[model samples]
Target: MSFQNTASFPGAGIPEQVSFDRKELSVILSLYGRMVAAGEWRDYGISSLRECAVFSVFRRTAEHPLYRIEKRPKLRNRQGQYSVVGIDGQILKRGHDLKTVLRVLERKLIRAVD
Candidate 1:
């Protein structure tokens, strides 16, 4: 029996995973910290997928995420690369600028503090 060598295939070794960069994470975490301090958010999860990266924010560990921040590089030119999704699967905001997209949640944070 002969087995085919998978290593000979092009792009076989490289994983096409997408994830938040240092600067992006820095911006997200800054908001997360503020929300946590205000008692609006608690648990969080990060997922790096082949197509997009997601940062999910949760009020509790077991419950669904209150929001999802997604980065889709493919959408960079079409609808911007960054997006904020609400719990109901609605696109809260979308833009090329990460900070601009996150401002939706920041508004919530302001309301949360009030």
Candidate 2:
């Protein structure tokens, strides 16, 4: 079996950090912009970790993240790769499609718009 570029450290078993590609980032940022314009979201941060890629949204910089969008490639076959987790660590949505999972957050945006 070949590890290739994905699993760089063959012996360490640390596996490289997961990350969002340009296209994925574009989609995430598009929603972020709309939410920001609606004043639903104030700040955001991205974290690429060994297990998953996280995009955390904060209403205020000092407070905890209000929501987190995570991508775990390992779950792509089982529970799906995309998930929306709330501030309380509850899974709001989980699916194979990233956009579909992110729809959960759009509900807040809808409320903010009207």
Candidate 3:
């Protein structure tokens, strides 16, 4: 009997586990870089899961994350794909355009130096 190839073949390259794209990453990193230099963020983590992709920012490696940038492709048509969540699990913003949604974080960067 001839052997049939299964869908989960060993040599098959698995698709991406997460949804965030290059343009999304550029926006996230752009803000992250500034926060890093400003001493507001010290570390970060990336998680690509079946449901969503997340970029978590932290003030320290061992502490809880300060913020999370998530891409939920499933929500693209309804609420949009990009979202920024706070440490308390509150959604700070959500939108189709990454740049616009990220503006909230930029606002945090502004301050008055006395």
Q: What are the lDDT scores of the predictions, listed in order? A: 0.94, 0.90, 0.88
Off by over 4 Å in 1: 1-9, 12-15, 111-114
> 1-114 in candidate 2: lDDT tens per residue?
876566555557666789999989999999999999988889999999989999999999999999999999999899999999999999999999989888888877654335
Which candidate's lDDT is highest? 1
TM-score: the better of candidates 1 and 3? 1
Q: Where does candidate 1 have its weakest 10-residue lDDT segment?
A: 105-114
- Model 2 earns a TM-score of 0.84
Best-first order by TM-score:
1, 2, 3
Write down the TM-score for model 3: 0.83
For each candidate, give its TM-score against the true structure: 0.85, 0.84, 0.83
